[model samples]
Target: MSALIDRFNRRIEYVRLSVTDRCDLRCTYCMPKGFKDFSEPDEWMSFDEIERVIAAFGRLGVHRLRITGGEPLVRKDLPKLVNRLYHLPGIEDLSLSTNATRLSKNADSLYQAGISRINVSLDSLKPDRFKSLTGGKLEKVLEGLMAAKNAGFSPIKINMVVMRGVNDDEVESMVEFCIKHHFTLRFIETMPMGETGQSASSQYLNLQTVKKQLARRYELIPGMMPGGGPARYVRVAGTDLRIGFITPISQHFCETCNRVRLSVEGTLYLCLGQEDKMELRSLLRNGITDYELERTLRQAIDLKPERHEFNEEPSKVVRFMSKTGG
Candidate 1:
């Protein structure tokens, strides 16, 4: 089988597919208030189209698939999509990234449908502060997380975007909470993606500092985990819980980037920090053959940028992280 290789020889094996751009929460760092600009329902790739796209990638040796959204749980009948992709030939891994507000109700169905891993976005443990940062109820997210755990999801990851003045003080408490629950913890450094992201970049706290703080508390032994994303891992000396650092700013991991993002509108984003893209919806809707689709995908991958320019030009990309599928 042929593989998708870029000019830099990075083999593309993973794809972050956005099923929807609609999210329930108005997180200050993600979506701004009263943000009404959303893609039309018809504009999103239908379940069949999504399946075909993934199958095309699968035939080209892409085995890892991550379903993301503004919050993936908000999409209707998402488990149906999950089930379809789970059984696709050559697709070896399937995961979801959600805010966890709706997980309480959908966790069991999702787990049964074959989602092996989950990444929940939880920035604060304090109820009021959680609401202030994400305009979401902390209890709802907490309940959803417990439900996901009980449903038998292993290595459940808690993604905490550590900010300086906002929720940096809660890092220790967050780690304690993750340890108590046996969930893996990952710290993400905020990137200036769009207007909201640029505004939130003011609170950007370097992960190196956070790592130093963590080392002071626990012996962080360098470790590795099973996944295709760009998170560096460290195992806390005395526990099974692993901590991951996604330092896009203080440190960029673009050299090893092996994945690309596909927006809900069927646009393949070659790089998050760059606007290079290829429209696939029109080709799909116009009766493009599987062979043609695969060829188009290869053409798209050939244009993947070597690295993103987030540090050099913070405001270069103007689209929100929500629109970019987390």
Candidate 2:
């Protein structure tokens, strides 16, 4: 089968699957109040259900997959799920995105289970500031980072959500750490999301400003990050470190968007900054065949928007970034 191209002619080759929407942190940008209306135990798609959907995607030439969550590792025995997805025929790349709190304990097992790459979200390098920002101990995430490196995951990425005054002060510190450790660091602009809706509007920091600050100290050579996401990667001259800017707010990447999201409750979303979505869990539970599933997905992808009007309408999304599996 050929790849599915959207109305804009962008081929959809990746999918983000949110295994769970529950997190152990109270990151103000993602979940101000910690938890959400969690999907009931029965509401979450089963491993079998997820596999079928992934297989359907594979037939459509969508071979890359990334698992996400409020915290994906927080879900019980996540390596088992990883192992399952690893064996699927069409999955060329498999990864997980998390806060890395659980990575300390599960990194080794997760690596052995076929997850070779990971994206760990770390906002601040200062312990106190990090605690205040995410409501989690910074030491735990650091420990997880070490464990991940030792586990042999290549291109372990640090996703730092840069804000105006929140963690912007530590941008240099974050870059130094990544430079020292040979890790890829991506600075993401805050988007207006979550129930409180305070992070994006109040805390949004332009990446262009951050880039200027970086250019003063180190030479940032232009490049792209491997295992492609939205980030525009740049090489830090004379170092193994690479800096990435995911400017969803300041600069939208929707025109080149090549991914879709499947929430824990089985909903399929075409755009990250939009509220519209298609119900897939129900259709799966209703026993649709693989062929029918592929047809439905093609129809949805055909309607995928060329861009997300986040700046035009900041309140476009009220759901937390956690629920959306960003």
Candidate 3:
């Protein structure tokens, strides 16, 4: 089968599927301090429906899948869904982007269910600072990370959203932690994907400046990860750890964007920064034929934005990142 190609000729091989939008923690930047904006239970796509959609995507040459959410682990019986997706015919890689709040309880089960890669979002190592940043105990995440390590997940990556003043001091300390544990560290530039609901916008901290210092401190050799996203990588000289930067604000990597996102509501977000989405829930439940499903997906690909516009004081063209499974 021919690959799902977007308007710009980028092969769409990866999909970030959000199982549920309900999260256990309220991160300061990610969600409002007292936010509880979760869709109704029935509104969520069922496991069967999710599998069928994934199967359709697999038929269209989508090979990599990342289970994401407000917090994927918060969804009950997630391993069941993970097990199903892992056995999909054309799926080459299965992973999850999580906060690790519940990884300790489920990491072994997730690994047994065929998920071998994981990305944990941890902004600060200081317990007090972490509590202030994410409104959750850092100790739980630490325990979960240890569980992931014990479960034998390879190449665990820690994602740190760098803000100019908040937790930015932890950059070196976070790097030190990753180096000590032999984990990949990725510093992401906080994006204005949407307004305060999506996330509280702050002064973005470009990783290039940090990269310069790190380069001066150690040899920075360019490298790549196994799958998905456009974050560039640099090896840490003589160690197995690699430092990564997901700079949506400082550097645009959309030209090479090769993935689409599926929101919990079954909307296909062609670009992370755009609101253009195609509703697929009705089609899936209406018993749409495989041919029709493929047609709808291809049409959605045609609508994928060339790039995101995030330069203004507040980018007015995007949805809440939580709604889109960021």
Best by TM-score: 1
Candidate 2 lDDT score at position 215: 96
Model 2, runs deviating above 4 Å: 34-36, 198-200
Which scores better on lDDT, 1 or 2? Answer: 1
Q: Could you give candidate 2's per-residue lDDT for residues 4-48 as a string of tens digits?
A: 998899999999999998898888777766365677769888988
The lDDT for every candidate, in the order shown, is 0.93, 0.87, 0.86
What TM-score does prediction 3 earn? Answer: 0.96
Candidate 3 regions with alpha-carbon error over 4 angstroms = 197-199
lDDT per residue for candidate 3 within 238-266, as digits (tens), equals 88888889987778898999989998889
RMSD of each: 0.7, 1.2, 1.4
277 in model 3: Cα distance from truth in Å? Answer: 0.6
| Best-performing candidate as measured by lDDT | 1
Instruction: Quote the positional error of residue 72 for candidate 1 in Å.
Output: 1.1
Off by over 4 Å in 1: none
Worst 10 residues of 1 by lDDT: 69-78
Q: In order, how many clashes per candidate?
A: 0, 0, 0
Model 2 RMSD vs true structure: 1.2
What range of 10 consecutive residues in model 3 has the weakest lDDT sum? 194-203
